[model samples]
Target chain A: MNESWDEIGQLFKNARSIVILSHVRPDGDAYGSSLGLAWTLRALGKEVLVCNEDGMARSYRFLPGSEEVVSTPKTAPQGCDIVIAVDTSTQERLGPTFALWNRKVDINLDHHASNTCYGTWNLIDPLAPASALVCYKLLQALGWTCPKEAASCFYVGLLTDTNAFRFCPLSPDVFRMAAELVEQGADPLSLSEGAYRNYSIGQFHLLREILAQTVFAWENRVAYYRLTPALLKQTGAENTEVENFLTYLQKVSTVQVAFMLEELEPNLTRVSLRSRAPIDVCQIAQRFGGGGHPRASGIRARIPMAEMEKLLLEEIRQVLQ
Target chain B: MNESWDEIGQLFKNARSIVILSHVRPDGDAYGSSLGLAWTLRALGKEVLVCNEDGMARSYRFLPGSEEVVSTPKTAPQGCDIVIAVDTSTQERLGPTFALWNRKVDINLDHHASNTCYGTWNLIDPLAPASALVCYKLLQALGWTCPKEAASCFYVGLLTDTNAFRFCPLSPDVFRMAAELVEQGADPLSLSEGAYRNYSIGQFHLLREILAQTVFAWENRVAYYRLTPALLKQTGAENTEVENFLTYLQKVSTVQVAFMLEELEPNLTRVSLRSRAPIDVCQIAQRFGGGGHPRASGIRARIPMAEMEKLLLEEIRQVLQ
Candidate 1:
C-alpha cells in the first residue's frame, strides 16, 4: 500500500501528521520547495511540520509557510509521521538531524543533477528548480486545488530559483510549471523584491569593504577579494555577503573570472568562483571535491586561509592559461 | 556620373585624399562603421584619413587604426572627391568640421533612432547598430571584399555600439550585417578586449571614490551616489571614470531605482539612473527633458548640484512609492 505515488497520497490521507525537511544552508529553491511541499500537504488534511537545520533567510519571509519552519527539536514530538525531504541530495546535508526521527518512513524529493537517491522512497528529477515545482504538480495529480498558501509557496521557489528567469538553471518543464504558478496569482514585483532586494546594512558595508580591497589580476583578466573572519567581523558581515560581493565583481569590464575566499575557520576556507566567459570554474571546484555548474560553483578547500587565497589565484591563472 | 553607386566607386577609385569623420562620442558603431568604410575605400585605391574628436579611451586602443585616429587636425590639401560621415545622424554631433561642409555634396550614413534625415545621401536605418554595419554592406556595394584592416575597423564599431550584444539596442538586420563583417575578418575576441578591456587605474580609483558617497532614498528603494568634481580631481580620474560609475548605485541590494549624480559643473549635474526591475527610470528622465531606456537612462539637469540631487532623488522615489 506504500509503494507508488497513489499509495503515497493514500498514506497522506491516512496519516495525521507530516514533517517536510529541506537541506541546511537553505537557498531560494531549497526554501521554496520546502514551504510549497508543506503547504500542499497541509491542504491534504495533514498536520505538517516544516523543519530546517538553520533559520530562514530574511528575504524569504513572504513565503506562506516560511515563518512556520521549526529549527529546534523541542517543536517536534516523538513521531513526525512520514517525513518528506525536499532539495536535499544527500543525508549529510540534512545535517545532524537524521536521528531525530525514531526510524520513521521517508519520501525524498529533489532536483539536483547529482541526486544520491537517499530517501527510502526517492523521487529525484534534476530538471526542476525546487522540489516544490514537482511537489506542486504532484498535489495537482492528487486532485488538490492549490490553495493560496500552496500557490504562494511554489511561486516563491520558482521566483528565486530562476532570478525572474534572468539566469534560469531549470529545464522547459520548469518554466511551463512557473507559468502555471503565475497564472494562479504569482505577483512578479513582490517576487523580484523578495529574492533580489533582500540585503542587509552589514552586507552593503561588506560589499564596499571587499570592493575596496579588490585586486584586479589584470594579466589573467581576473578579479578577486577575500573575507577573513576578522575582516567579516570588522565589517559585521556574514559568509553570505562574500557570496553576493562576487556577483558584482563578475561584471567588471573585461573580467571573465571572479573568485571570493571566505574564512570558515581560523585557518580553513571556502571558495566560490564565477566565470562569465568560457572558463570552467566547475572543474577547478571539483578538484576540491565540491561540484557545481560551469558558470557558478563552490569548493571547500581546507587549506590555511592565506595559502588558500594564493592557491586559488595561482590555480586559476595556471588552469585558464 | 556623381549620382550612381558605381560612379561614386569609380570617382573614389582615383581619389588622392578622403577625410573620414564619425559622430562625436565615437562609439563602437561609429568607429566600426567609419573605420571599416575607410579601409574598404583605401583598399579600393583611395587615400583615406580617419579623423576623430579626441583620443579614444585606452580600452579602444586595440581597435584597428585606433592608434592613427586624428584627434587634432594638422594640414589638409585641396578637397578630396569623397567625404563620408558615419554614425552621425545630426550635423551638430559631427561638431566644427560638419558645419563647414555643404549637405548636398556629402555622403552620410547613420542608425540613430532619432536621426534627423540630415545628409545629402543619407542611409538612415535606425535599426542598425553602428553605421559601420551599414558601411560593411556598402563595401559589398563598392564591389570590394572586406580587407583585414577594413574588417577590424567594422569589428570595433560593431562591438562598441552593440555593447558586444549585452546591450542589444539595435535591430536584427544590424546583427546579420555584423555576422558578414566577422566572416570578412573581424576577430571578436581581440575585438572584445580592445573594446571592453584595458581599464585604466584612474578609472578604477574613480570607481572607489564614487562608491564612497553612495546614499539611499530608502523608503522608495531608490539609491543614488555622488561623483563630485572634487572626487574626480582627487583621484586624478578621467570623465570616462564617471561613465563607468554610471551603474554602481543601481546594484545596491534594495535599490530598484539607482542614480549617479556627477557634477559636470557647480550648477549643472549629469544624472545617470539604472533599474534592475521594471520601474521605468526613463519616464522620470523624460519628465526632466532627457530620454533613454527603461533599465538604463540619463538626465542632465541644471540647478545647484546638491539641490539637483535632492530634487531628482525625490522625483524618482515618487515612482516606487
Candidate 2:
C-alpha cells in the first residue's frame, strides 16, 4: 500500500487537471473524500472537478463544495489529465454511463478490503474506518494545508461513515484526526446536525406509526415493522426516508434480527434487514437475490407483506439456530 | 484556576486518605471523574473512597470500579483527610447527609459556570466540557499515569457529558482527550453501548406508542407527546425510562420546541421540555417553577393533561412572539 500510495502521489503530482470520481448513490464519505481531495488539489494550483453519479445526500448539502459536485458529466474537461476514484470499491459501482473519455482510472483511493486494485495506482487500506481519513493523510503527504472547508468535508465523512462515531473501526487515530480537523475549524455540532439530526417531521411521523405497529416473534428476538402506502401518504414521507427506520427496530435489545417491510407496490415489498452478532442478515438478503454487508442488507420481494414477514422470520430463526 | 489547582495538588500530596463526592443523582461525568480520579489516586498509593448520593446510572454498571461506589454512606470513611467534590457546583448539591466530619471542603472541581467556588481550593472551568476533562488535566499536572481503567472511566465521562459528541460542548480538547483515552484501552464501541445503546424492549414499545399519539401544533413547530398511565402499564415501562423520550420529539427539524407530558397522578402531569437554539426552554420551565438548561428543562403541573398542554402552549407561543 505504501508503494502504491507513492505511485498515486506521483500521479497526483504530474496531473494539472484532474477529475475525482466516486460510486453512484454517493454517501457522505464519498462526497467528503472526493470534494476534500479536490479542494486540496485545487489549493495546490491544480484544476479539480468532482463528479458523482448521484449529486449528494440532501442532509449533506450544507457541507462545503457539496453544491459543486457534478451529477452528470456529459463532457470531461478538455484538459483532464487524471481520473482518481475514491471510496469506490468496484469500477462498475462508479455508476453506469460514467467514463472519462474512456480513460482508465489513474488512481484509486479506498478503504474496502475487497478492492480489486484495478487502477494504475491503488492506495487502499481496508482497515481504514473511512476513505476520508485516507484522504486527510494523503493531503498531509502531499504537503498541503487542510483548509477549514476541506476539514469540514472530511469531518462529515468520518462522522457519517462511523454512524456518528458509534460504529466499529473508530480507532484512536480516527479520533485524533477528528480532533485535528476540528481544531482546524470543523464545527462538529453543526456537522452532526447536518449529517444525522436534519430529519423532516414526516419521517418522524412515519417512524412513529411503524414503531407502534411493529410485530415481535421468536420471544421478541425477531422484530419487524411494516409501512404501507397509506402510512406513507399520511406522513408525506418519500421512500428514501425509510432507509434508517430499521435502526430503531434494531435498538430493541432482545431483537437479534430486525427488519422493515415497505410496500413499494401492491405485490412488491422492499425488505431492509439488520442483525446483531450471531446472525448474518446479508446472507438472507443474498438468498433473496440481494446483498450487502453482514449486519445490514436489503431485497425486493414479489410477495405479500405478511407472507414475506413470515418467511423472513423463519429464515432468521434458522440462522439463529 | 491554576493557583487553585496547585493548592488542590498540594492537598492531594498531603492527604493519605481521600473521599471523592459528586452531586446527588450523579451523572456520567460525576461517576467518571470521581472514579477516574480515584483510580489514579489509588495508583499513587493514596487511599480513595468514592461516594455518591445515588450510585452510578444503571447503564454505566460496565464501568470499572462502579461497584465500589458507596451510595449509602452512614459516615465518612475512616482516616479521610481530604474531601474533593467533583461535578458539583454547590456544596449543598452533594446531598443532605454529606459532610467531612464538619471539616471544610478541601477542594472543589467542576465544569458548571455557576459554581460557587465553595471549597478551600477550587478548580472550576465553566468552559470545560465535563468535569472529567478537569480530572484528566489534574492527573497530568500531578504526573500520574492514567491506567486503562481510569481511561475508560474518563471516556465514559466524555462520551456521556457530550451526549456522544453531538452536544455543543465538544471542543477540540475533548476529542484529543477521547483519543488519548482510547489509546489507553478505552473501547469506544463498548463505552457507547454502555452509555446510550442499552435500551430495554419495553422502552421501545412505550416509545412507539408515544410517537403514534404525538400532537403537533403551531405549524408543527411545537410538537408534544403524551404518555398515559395505561400505556406505561401495558408496556411495563418504568417512569425513568421516559427520560430520553423528548429526544425523538427534538428530532423533527421544524420542531422549535418539544415536550412530553406524562401523567404522574390523576390530575398531575410532569412535562419534560426540549428546544433548539433561539429559544430558552429553561426560561419556559421557570414560569412553572422548574429550572434547567436552555435546551432541556422540566416542570410538574397540578392540572389535567389537556389544560396543562394548552397553558404550556400559550406560554411557549408568547415566548415565540
Candidate 3:
C-alpha cells in the first residue's frame, strides 16, 4: 500500500458525507478520478456526491456514475465531513464547490507540479499519472474490492493523463495496477470510444483549419499553430473544443519545440508547448508564472498575439541557447 | 566524438559507394534512420544506394532523401565499403537485403530491446528512443552539419519510435540531440502532416470498428480487442490499419494488460500487448518465445482462439497475482 493511503482510507470510512470535486472544464483524468472515487465510495455504502465546475461532454457519459454528477457548485451538499478535490489546483478552478471546502476538511488529491497545497492534507505527487491513480492507491490501501465500474473509471483516468500510455511517463507500477483493474472488469472499447474517439466533427473541422494555418519559423525548428477565438465563434465550437489540440503539433519531423496557442480573448492566449527533447517548458512556463510537466507545459499570458509571439520566441530561444 | 563514428566518417571520406538498408515493412523509425543516414552520407560526397522491402507511402516522400530510395535489393552497389542496416535487428527483419549482408560488412544500428546483435559492429541500445537518434549522434560525432533535411529525417525516426514522446523512455541525451537537430532547421508542420494526419479514411474507419469491438476481461484485469481477417476484408482495411489501434486500447483506465489480437490466418494471431506496470509483457511474451519491452511487448502465435485466449488469460492472471 502507498504511504498516507491508510489515512485516506480511514478518511473515507469515517466520513458521513463526501463531496467529490475536480477542476473546472474537467479533463478526462479529473472527471474520471472524481467519478471513480465516488463510485467506489458509493459501493462502500457511503453518500458520495461528485461535482465539477462544468458539465461533462456527451462522450464521457459511459463512465459508470457520470449520470449522478452535479455540475453546479452552489448546489453542493451542506455539512460534509470531507471535501475532496480530485485534480483542481487553484481555488478559482473549483468553480461552484469553492465554498464547500470552507465548511469542512479539505483533502486535495492532484498530480500537478503547481498544486498550491490548499488542502489540510495535501497529496500532490507531480510524478503521479492521474488523480484517479491517487484514488486507486487509497482504495487499494483500504482493501476495497474496487468494483468493476470503479476500476473502469480509474483506467480511463490513467490512460487519458498518460495519453494512452504514450506520454504520462508512467512507471512499471502504473501498468501493474492497471492490470489488476482489468482483471476486475474495465472495458477498453468503452474507454477508447469515450476518450479518444470523442473527437466530434466540429473538432475535426477545427483541426483541419488549424493545420492549414500552421506557421513555421526560426528556420522550421520552431513551429506553431493556433486556434483563433474568431474561428471558434465561427465554428460554434465550445471553449473546451480547443483542449488537447497541442497533441496535433507533435507529428512534425523537424520541430524541436511545438506550440499551439489558443486565443482565449482579444488579448489572452493560452500557450501549450511540447518539447521534442532537451527543452524543459516547465522552466520556460515558470518564467511566465504558469507551469506543467517537463515535456508538455502551458502558460496563459494575456498579451497581443504579435507581442506574445515575439516574447515567446525570445523566451524559448533562451532555453535553446 | 562517438568511438566508431569517426571511422564511419572516415569511411565516408574515402569510400564512394554506400548502401542503406532498413528493417522489413519499415516504419517511420526504420525509414527515417535510413533516410537520415543516407542524406548524411550523400552530403559527404558518397554515392548512396538505399533499398528496402516496403513500398514507400506518400507520407514518407517528405523524408529528405526519400525520393532517392530504391525498393529492389538488386540496386545495392557491389563491393560497398560498408552496408549500414539503419534499424534492422534480426537478419530476417533485414527484409530483401539479408543476402547482400553475407558479402559485406554489416553495421547494424538499432534501438529495439530485442536486438539480436548480428552485425560486425552492433550499435544497439534499447534505451535510445530510435535508430534515427543514433544516426544523429553518429553524424554529430562525425562533425557533420545536420542539414534541415537530415534533421527532418532524424525527427521522424525519433517522433515515430517514441510515439511522439509517449513510447520512448527518453533520457537527457535524447533531448540534447534534438536540440542540435533543431539548430539545423527541422520543419515540424510538414512532419506532422506527413506522420500523423496522413492516415487514410479507410484506416480511420477501421480504427472506429476496433474501438467499438474492444473487450475487457475485468476479472482477469486484462483488456483485449481483436481484428479478424474477415473483419478487415469486410471493411477493406489492411494490416497497416493496425498501426495506432493499440494506442486506443492503452487508454482504458481499468485495463492493466491491453492487447490487440489480429488474425494473421485461419487460426494464427499476432498479439500486441501494452502494459502499465508490474507485468513485463516481454517476459510474458517470451513464454511463447516472443519478446519485446517491459511495458509494450509482442508475440505471434498460431493457436486456436479459445486456447490462445485461455493461455493469455492464465498468463495475465499470474502476472496480476
Candidate 4:
C-alpha cells in the first residue's frame, strides 16, 4: 500500500543517514531521481549515499554529484537509517545490491506502472512522466526546496524520459514543472547537450550504416533496419551504441511501425519494435515470448535474422490490414 | 522605432480586413507566427488572410489555417485594410510578395535581432526566442484570448524556433508560455511529430551518405560532411533536403565547429557552419562574403569544393586554437 506524504516526511526527518538505489543499467531517470533525492536530503543536513550497480556512464559524468554515485557496495553501509529505492520497478531490478541489503526497503518511489510495491512505504504515480518528477512532487509536498543541483538532475530525468518532450500525454504540469526547474537554475541547453548531443563519432558511423540499410515495406507504412556483427565491427561501435538507431526509421513520416533487427549471433536475433500509429506492438512481442509497453516492445528470437524478419513482417502485415 | 503594445492593439482593432505575411522559404517560426496571428484576429471577428511567398510545406500543412495560406498573389488582394509581417527579418526576405503589396507594412512583429524594422509600427524583441512568442505577448497585452488553434500554431513556432528548447538563452518564460499554450489545448506530441518527425525516406538516405562521408579534423574538434552532386544523385535527394545535414556533425560530442560543404556547381560550393563551442563561426563566414549568427553561419564560395574545404578548415583551426 502507498503511504501518505506526511508519513514519508516523518521517515525522512527521523533518518540521519540514508541510502538511495535505482535499477541496474541506469538511465537518466534512474540517476536523476536517485541523485536528485540525494542532493535534496544532503541540503537538509542528512547524510545520503547514492549507488547504482553499473555506476555512471561517461556521457552523464558532466552531471553534478555524478562523481558521488558509487558502485553498489558488497555489503550495505553501516548506520544506514533508511533504504530508498527510486525508479526501480521491482526489487529484482536493484540487481545484486538487493541481496546485500538486510533491511526492508524504507520507501520505493517510482513512476512505472509495472512497479511492484516492494517497500515498507511506496510513493508511486504511474501517471507521472518521469520518476524524477515523482521525486520533485514529493519534495514539494514535504515543503522542501530543491537545490539547484537537484533541479538539474531532475530536469535531465524529465527531459530524457520524455525524449526531449516528444513523447505523448505531456500535461500542462509537465511544462510548468520544467519552467520551475529552469527558474531554479536548470540550464536546459547545457543539460540537453550533455544528455542528447553527446553521441560519439563511432556511434555516428554505426548510425550511418543503419540508415543506409533501412528498408521500407507495406506501402512505406513499415520501416526496418538490420544491424549485423560485421556492421558493428566495421563501425567500431558496440552493440549498445545502436539502441537509438530506430529513431531514424521513426523520422519517416509515412512509417506507422518501425523496428530494428540486431544479429546477436548467426542464429540469434534481437528485434525491437516501435509503433507511431494505433498498433499494439507489445501484443506482437508477447506472442514471441517478450513484453513491453504497447508502443514499444522487444523480442529475442533463436531463429536466424532473415527468418525472424519474415515472421515479424507477416505478423505486422496482418495487423496493418 | 518600435510601437507600444497599446498602439499595436489600436492598429489591430481599427483594421477590418488584414493580410499577414511571413518570410520566403518559411520555417516553423514564419508559418507559426503568421497563422497564429491570423487565427487570433479571425477569432475577434476580423477578416485575416495569411500569405507566404513559398506557401506552406506539406509537413506544416497539418497546422490549423494552413490551407488558407496562399502563395504571394500576382498582386495584393482588394480591400486589405493592413499588411502585417510576422517573422520576416527584412523586407527583402518577404520575397516577391513585398513588391505586390502597394502599401507599406502597417506592423512588423518579429523576434529576430537583425530585423530591419521595415514597417510603420514595429514590435521586435531580440530575446523572445520566437517571433510567435512576440505575437503571443501582443495578443496577451491586448487582452485577447488566444484561440485553441492559435495556441497550437504558436506552440509549433516555439518548439521549432528554439530547436525544441535546445537553443541557448531559454528564459523561464519560454516554458511558462509552453504550459499556457498546452493548457489552451495545444497538442505537444502531435505538434512535435508534425514539425520534426516528418522527414522523408529520401532525406534519411541523404543523411546516411552524409554521415558516411563525415570527416573529423583538428583532433576531432572540427567535423564536416560534403554533399556532392554525385551523392545527391545516387540517393535521389534534392539539394534542399541536405540543408540540415550539419545537424549530424553537430551531434558529435567532441566537435566544436561543424560544417557542410555542398557542391552547387563545378566551382561553386556552398558551405554551412555551426559552432557548439564559443568559437565565432560568423567571423569565418564573413571573410568569405557570407553572414549569419555567431553560432550558425553560411558562405557561398566560388572556389572548387576541395579548395573551399581547405580554406574553411584553416579558418576554423585558427579560431579553435
Candidate 5:
C-alpha cells in the first residue's frame, strides 16, 4: 500500500490535467472522495474533472463542489494526462465511463477489499472505513493543505460511510482524523444535518406503510418488513428512500437479524439483510449468489415475496439453531 | 466561573471524604459527571460516594463503578468534609438527599445556565455542551490525569447528552475532547453501542403502532402522534421507552413542530413537543404550565386526548401564522 501510495503520488506529480471518477450511483463517500481530490488537485493548479455515469444524488448536493460534477463519458480536455478512479472496487462499477477512459487507470484509491487492482498503481486498504480517509492520507503525504471545502467533502464521506459512527468497526484513529477535519473547517453538526436529517415527506409515508406490515418471528429475534410496489405507488416514495429501512429492525435488542424485502416487480424480490448478533448475514446472501459486508448483505430472487421471505426466515432459523 | 473553579479546586484539595450528587432520575450527563468526578476524587486519595435519589438507569449500568452509586439519601461517612453537586441545577433537583446534607454545598459543578448557585462555590458554564465537559475541564484545571475508567464515564455522558454528536449545539471542542478520551482508552464504538444500539423489542413494536397512526397537519409542517394506554398495552411498551418517539417526526424535511401526546390516565394527557424550525415549542409548553429547552419541551393537560390535540393544533397554527 505504501509503495502504491508513492507511485500514485508520483503519477499526480507528473500529470497536469487529471480526471477523477468514482462508482456509479455514487454515495456520500464516492462524492466526497472525488470532490475532495478534485479540490486538492485544483488547489495545486492542475486542471481536474470529476465524473460519474449516474449523477450525484439530491441528498448529496449539499457538498461544496458537487455542482462541478460532470456526467460520465464527457470529453476531457485534449491535454488530460492522468485518470484516477476513486472508491470503485471493480472496473465494471465505473459504469460506461470505464470504457470511455480508454487508457489504463493511472491511480486507483479505494477501501474495498474486493478492489480489482485495475489501476497501474492501486492504494487499497480494506481496513480503512471510507475512501475519503484514503484521499485525506494521500493529500497529507503529498504535502497538500486541506482547505475548508475539501475538508467538508471528506467529513461528509466519513460520516455517511460509518453511518455517523454508529458502525462498530470505527477505530479511534477515525475520530482523531475527524477532529483534524473539524480544525480544517468541517462543521460536523451541519454536515450531519445535511446527510441524515433531510428526508422527503414521501419517505415518512413510506415508512408508515412499511412499519404497518412489519412481521416478527422466532420469538421476535427475527424481524422483517416488506415494501411492495403498490405501497411505493401509494406513498410516492422512490426506491432510494428504503436504503435505511433495515436500521429500524437492526436496533431491536432481541433481533439477531433483520430482513427487508423490496418487490422490484410483480414476481421479483430484492432482499437486504442486517445482522446485529454473531450471525453473518453476508454468508446468507452469498448462498443466494449475492454478497456484502458481514453485517449487511443483499440478493435478488426471482420469486414472489412470500416464497422469498419463507426461504430467508428458514435460513435464519437454521443458523440460529 | 473562574473564581468558583479556584475555590472548588481548593476545597477538593483540602477534602478527605467527599459525597458527589447529581439530579434525580439521572441521565447520561448526570451519571457521567457524578461518576467521572467520583473516579477523579478517588484518584486524589479521597473517599467518594456517588448518589442519586432515583438511582442510575439500567442503560447506564455499563459505566464502570456504577454499582457503587448509592440511591440516596444514604448516610455519608462521619467526617465527610465536603458535599459536591455535579450536574444538578437546583436544590430540589438534588432530591430529598439535598436536605440530608446538613452543611452547605462546598462545590456545585454544572452546565445549566439556570444553576441556582445553592453551593458555597459554583462552577457553571452554560456554554458547555454537557456537564461531563465541565467535569473534564475541572479535572484539567486541577491537574488530574483521567484514567481509562474515568474517561469512559465522561465519554458516555458526552455521547448521550449530544445524541452521539448529532446535535447542532456541539462545537469542535467536543470532538477534540472525544479524541482525548479515546486516547485515554474510551472506545467510541462500544460506548455508542451501549448507549444507542441496545433497544428493547417492545420499542420496535411501539414504533410500528405509532407510525401507523401518525397525523400530519398544517400542510405537513406539523406532525403529531399519540400513545394511548390501549396501544401501549397492546405493544407491551413501557412509558419510558416513548421518550424519544418525537424524533420520528423531527427528521421529516418539512416538519416545524412534532408533538407526542401520551395518555397517562383516562383524562390526563402528557404532551412532549419537539421543534426543528424557528418556532419555540418551549413557549407553547409554558402556556400549558410546563417548560423545557427551545428544541424540546413538555406539559401535561387534564383534558382528554382529543381536546388536547385540538388545543395544540390551534396553538401551532397561531405560531405558524
Candidate 6:
C-alpha cells in the first residue's frame, strides 16, 4: 500500500524493535540509508538492527555505525516488531536475507521508480534524488531531529548516488536537504573523500591498462574498452574496482556512446553501456535481453567477447547514424 | 577600501555604464562571474560590458552570454561610468587589460584571500565559495532576484570554483545559495556537462598516455608523470587541455604526493604538485620560485626535464620521509 509519511512515522514510533535491510552487494545508498535510519531510531531509544546480504564495502567502513551492521541477524525476525527495507527496490534484491525472514516487510522506503512495493506500507518518492533524502524527510515529518551520525550517513548516500551531485537532476530541495544535513554535522569533504577519492594502487594500474586499450569508432563518437580476467590478474585489481571506469570514456567530448566489454567467462561477456542525452542505451541493452535507464544500461551476452563487441557495435552504430 | 553590500548596491544602482574585467588565462569562475554580473546589470536596465585578457575558453562557450565577453574593450574604458573587476585576485593579474583602463576601478568583487583592495569599493569575502556567489549575495541584499541567465552563469562559477563542490568547505549557506540558484533556473546537469564533462578526444588520449607512463615511488605514496612536447604532439592535445590531469594521480588511495613534470620547453620544465593533508607542497614549490596553497602548488624551473624530475623527486622524498 502507498502510505503517507505520517503513517510511517506512527508505525516506527509504535514499534519497540525494528530491523532494517538493504539490497545485496550494498552500495553507499543501501548502507547509508540502512545505517542512517538505524542511527535515527537508536537516538529515539528504540532497538534497531541493520543488515545487508553482502555486508559493507571496505570504502564505507568509515561511516558511523558501520561496524554494527551484521550480515546475518543474531536474533529471530519474529522478535522484531517491524522489518523495514531501505534502498532496496524489490523484495528479491534483499537477496538471501529475504529468505531468512519470511514475514511481510512492514515498511519499504525507496526512491527508485522500479520499486515493487512488496511491503505492507510503502513510501517511495521517485522524485527524491536519493533514498537518504526520503529518510531525512520522514524524520522531519515526525518532528524528530536527525542525529549527527545519521546526517553523515545520509550525506554519503546523497553524495555517491548522485555521483557527487553530477548525475542527478538537482532540485532545490536536494540542495536544501544537503544544506540541513551539513548544518547537522555532515562533513561533505570528508564524506566525499572517503566515498570517491579512495582508490587503491591496483585500481589505478587497472585504469591505466584499460585506458591504454580504449578503441574509438564512428568519428570518435563511440568509445569502448575490453577488460579481461588476464588483465585483472596482471593488475591485481578486483572486478568491483572497474565499476566506474566507463565514466572515463563518457567524459570524452565527442563520444556519444561509451561501453565496456568485460569478459566474465570463456564464452560469456558482460557489457555496460552509457550514452549522452537523446540516446537511449537502454534500448540497445534491451535488444540483448538486458535493460536499465535511458542513459545507462547493461547486458550479459552468452557469446564470446569479440562476438558480443561486434553485435553491440552494430547496434550502437545504427543509433548513431 | 572595504565596502558594505548596501554601499556597493548603491554604486551599481547609480552607474549608467559599467565595464567588467577578469584575470588573464580566464577560468570558469572568471567568465562566470563577469557574465553573471553583466546579465544582472543588464536586467537592471544598466549598460554593461564584460572584457577579459584571454577571452572565454572554447569549453565555456556554451555558457549563456559567453559570446558577449570580449578580449578587448569595444569603446574606451573612460566611456563607462564604472569599472568593476570580478574574480581577479591582484591588480596585475588583470594583465594588459588593466593598462587599457587607466581609470581607478569603481568596484572589485572577489573571493580570493589574496585579493588586493584595488577598487574604490571592494567586496572581498574569502569565506565565500566563489566570486559569483558573492555577486549573488550582493543582488539578494539589494532585494533583486537573480535572472535565469545570471543564475546559470553563477552556478557554473560555483560549480567550477569548488571543483563541482568537492573542494570547498560546504557550509549550509553554500548549499542554500546553490539551491536558490537552481530554483532561479540553473540546470545543474547541463551546466556541469558544459563545465566539466566536455573533454576533447585529444585530451582523452593525453590522459591515457599520461596514465600509461605514471611512475610510483616510496611504496606508491608518491606518483608522478612526465609530459613532454612530443607526447602532446603525439596525442594532438593543446597545453591548455592538460590543466586538470594531475587529479588522476592524486586519487590513488596510497598516494600522498602527486606531481606532473611538463616540458614547457627544451630547457624549461613546469612542475605541478598536489598532496594530501599534513603535507605542505607550497613550501616545496616556494623553494623553486613558485607558490600556491598548501595542498596544491606549482613550480617552473629552467632545468631540463630529466634534471627537474630528479630534483623535485628528491624534495618530495624528503617530505614523505
Fnat of each prediction, in sequence:
0.09, 0.64, 0.02, 0.77, 0.58, 0.80
User: What 10-residue stretch in candidate 3 chain A is worst by lDDT?
Assistant: A165-174
TM-score of the first chain alone, every candidate? 0.87, 0.86, 0.91, 0.90, 0.91, 0.91
| lDDT for each residue of candidate 3 in A1-321, tens digit (9 for 90 to 100) | 123766767777789898887887678888889888888888878888887778776657778888888775664477677888888777667875566545433788888877778787787777777888888877766788788888889988987876665533445466566667666777654565567645444554565466556676775567687777788867666667464765555544456677877777778878878876566888888787777778777788877666777888888877773
Model 6 spans > 4 angstroms off: A72-78, A100-103, B73-78, B100-104, B318-321
Give one digit per residue, the lDDT tens place, for model 5 in A1-321.
644556666777788899898987688999999998888889988899888888777768889999888788645547879988999887777887557656777788999877889988888888888999999988888788898999999998888887777745666678888888888988876787778767788888888777778788999888888887788889987776485877777677677888898888878989989887478898999888777777777788788888888999989998873
Can you write out model 2's per-residue Cα lDDT over A190-218, one digit (the tens) per residue?
78766666678778877877787888889
TM accuracy, model 6: 0.93
Candidate 1, position A319, lDDT: 62
CAPRI grade, predicted model 2: medium
Q: How far off is each candidate at the interface, as Cα RMSD in Å?
A: 9.6, 1.5, 12.2, 1.2, 1.8, 1.1
lDDT of 4 by residue, B7-101 (tens): 77787788899999898778898999999999999999999889888877776887998999998887888889899998877887798756766
Clashing pairs in 2: none
How many clashes does each candidate structure show, in the order listed? 4, 0, 23, 0, 0, 0
Q: Model 5 residue B171 lDDT? A: 64
TM-score of each: 0.63, 0.89, 0.56, 0.94, 0.90, 0.93
Q: Which of 1 and 2 is the better model by TM-score?
A: 2
TM-score of chain B of each: 0.80, 0.86, 0.90, 0.91, 0.88, 0.90
Best by TM-score: 4
- Residue pairs clashing in model 5 are none
What overall lDDT goes with each candidate model? 0.67, 0.80, 0.71, 0.85, 0.81, 0.85
lDDT of 6 by residue, A135-165 (tens): 8888887888799999999999998888777
- Candidate 1 CAPRI-style tier: incorrect
All models, DockQ values? 0.09, 0.64, 0.04, 0.77, 0.59, 0.77
